[model samples]
Target: MSGKPGPSAAAVLPELPVTFRPVRTRVVLLTVGAGLLVVLTVVALMMPSGGAQPWGPGDRATMIITGLLIFALLAVLSRPKVVADDDGITVVNLVASRRLEWAEVVKVNLRTGDPWVYLDLTDGTSLAAMGIQPGGGRDQAVRAARQLRALAEARGTGQPGTR
Candidate 1:
């Protein structure tokens, strides 16, 4: 032996577990939707009103519904606990949550129409890794995906060909 130390056991061996940032698509969608709703509401309020025209039942109902929706959307967006962490990869669906181990993932695919990063599971199922989705354009999403892939590889949990 050259007496030089071999690869450190910690370096050569795969990390037993890894954690991934939870997805946040629902939160993002909800926030954008809420903002749009507020804009529309403001526009409606700004429209010229007929002289002496009282609000009708239908108009009142529409206003009430819109108000309720705005409140609900705001409430959903305010809570910051949407992200989840777990033994493997944490999944946050805004209304749903899932934890998946490395073995459960078969591959990672990024396609044009798909847009978001997707994980192909061993059971013929797939999950979206929304954390990697670009909020603005393709470049941001691609960058996020690359970072995620690098993290997975560092933990030895990435699917083959991911890097």
Candidate 2:
């Protein structure tokens, strides 16, 4: 045998660094939604007459709570995302987040008129990956779906203990 051995699979194949996020169109919604919230809050608070008057000792606390809740909700909805590496992917939706191994995903499906990409898992469950929504534009969504499929085909097949 030659002194040099054949390259191993890992050495021959480089990992794909993949990330998916809401399209730029989301910026518009985020800007408008957040701006509207801030404006309404200010208006309502200032309408108290002669100036912005403290409603009461509890006013500051109330405002803080309200603001935080609204901000958190908006942030979550407008920031759904997915990140995938060689091992697996992490999906972040509006109210939940999940980590999944490649072998867990059975298929990637994005049908016509569908709002977002959905991953059909081997465990008979499905996950909506809203980060690549059709609202972002057909072309963008298609491209993202293709990339995700390629990643899945490359690293998300059956494996020991994962099948």
Candidate 3:
């Protein structure tokens, strides 16, 4: 056998069990959500008790609950994430999450202006991978898409393209 080593698979493929998520989006959404909660708490406590409407305990509770609701909504916006591992890939969007084997993904694409990556599945349906969005980080998103594309090509039945 030749003493020379062949090209390393790890060099070509991204590290497995890699996770893709929007850094800026998560930071902004979580920070803003927490900030809004603090502001709401402060406002709730500062409100006068002798006002015409008489801000009572119930009123304060309502105000805090409203703030919590808003925070919950924002938290959903920060929930998109994708985990790629030896077994398969897991896609978590705002409201849905799905796991697919490597063979299930036929392609990975992130065309210009596309909000996020889209995976063409073997079922002829495309799944939106909100975890990698250009709006949060354009260059990072592209790089992630390319990495995902490489993974699909090397590990699955996906076709490679210039996308």
Ranking by TM-score: 3, 2, 1
Candidate with top TM-score is 3
Q: What is the lDDT of residue 153 in candidate 1?
A: 40
lDDT of 3 by residue, 27-81 (tens): 9999999889888988998899995777899989988888899899999999999
Q: Which stretches of candidate 1 lie over 4 Å from their true place?
A: 1-52, 56-61, 70-86, 156-159
User: Which candidate achieves the best lDDT against the true structure?
Assistant: 3
Note the clash tally of each candidate.
Answer: 0, 0, 0
TM-score of each: 0.53, 0.71, 0.89
RMSD of each: 8.8, 9.3, 6.4
lDDT of 2 by residue, 1-163 (tens): 1111223211223246667887575686577667756865775566544456546535645665676677666676787887888779888887888999998876666778888888878888889988888787887776676667656656777332222
Error of 3 at 145 (Å): 0.3
Ranking by lDDT: 3, 2, 1
Local accuracy by lDDT, each model: 0.52, 0.69, 0.83
